[model samples]
Target: MSDPAPRIVRRETHSPRSTAAVIVALCLAVVIAWVATEGVLSLLGLPALLLSPRGMLTSVAGAPDASAASVIAVAVAAGLVGVVLLAIALLPGRRARRPLHAEHAIVVADDTMLASALARTAARTAAVSADAVSVSLGRRTATVRIVPVSGTRVDRDAVRGAVTEEFTRAAPTRPARVSVLVSPAGKVGS
Candidate 1:
């Protein structure tokens, strides 16, 4: 029998600069401390090379410090770290956002004349705007009201139509209740 194909998976990638910088910062701290374990003087020598201007830092004229070997190694590591951090900084990261949703509910009654009522109710329920309130239907027996933006208007008849339409649209086996409420013009008095 043949082996099954390998599945491909998607992976997210992010800029390494922030991560690289953090890693380098940690490594640099360790390197400094490690040099001191050997001797304080070596620690002083390595920093000058690591931080100095370009040409002047090549290698000390003539013979190098016995500790120069470790200094060179540390410099290379720091350079590599710096590169990684910069690359990470340039990379993009992912952000998530959610879409807006309107409220919904179920309005219930006998299915006997639901189909007709739903069709007649289409226009009244179809218009939706920021000013317009959202409407829907599900099981039955429900009443809810909410603010429809000021310029936005809610038609009682249309609300009824929307619920009816949604209910009708459901398959015969999937009938649902309906109600479309437009909350008070401003606020519902306590």
Candidate 2:
């Protein structure tokens, strides 16, 4: 008898943060539209409750000059805004792990989930409690730290091998180098 085909799962690429950006952009667009409409109405001598660009400039011209404190405050606010925009532009937007490229479609899993699986594998292999294992996943590395039970010695090499084997089986898109560190202190409750 022939074996059946493997099932394929789709990966989601949407970022939750992108929704906040879209809503902010829509709000800004609405405010810009209102300002433009008001400006046009003022130009045509229609009744416009909102101030137009020209009216705003004329008001500023007739107003008293800004004090030193006010000028410094405005400069500080502008600097803060610039910093925020720069961070938004430079920071990595996606939180999803690298996608596993397949023949038909790509598959992706959360880094935390993959780390948890590797931790479980290591714990089982080391004969230690799951809580004794800690896994940290980086872009190109997976660090597994293990704490053995009190008065019990653990084979670091065996735990490392098991962790690396589990990571390989998981098959993350980008292969990560596995590093295992055995803590000096062990938990009393195992």
Give the alpha carbon lDDT tens digit for every residue of 4-84 in model 1: 221110011122245556877898899876544445444455444333432234454433663878778878997997787
Angstrom error of the Cα, residue 180, model 1: value is 2.2
True-structure lDDT of candidate 2: 0.76
lDDT of 2 by residue, 72-187 (tens): 88789989977876677666556656454456555677888888899999899889999999999887788999999888888878888888877776674457788888888888
Best by lDDT: 2
- Measured over all alpha carbons after superposition, the RMSD of each candidate to the real structure, in angstroms, is 17.3, 6.2
Q: Estimate each model's TM-score.
A: 0.25, 0.65
User: How many clashes does each candidate structure show, in the order listed?
Assistant: 14, 0
Task: State the C-alpha lDDT per candidate.
Answer: 0.45, 0.76
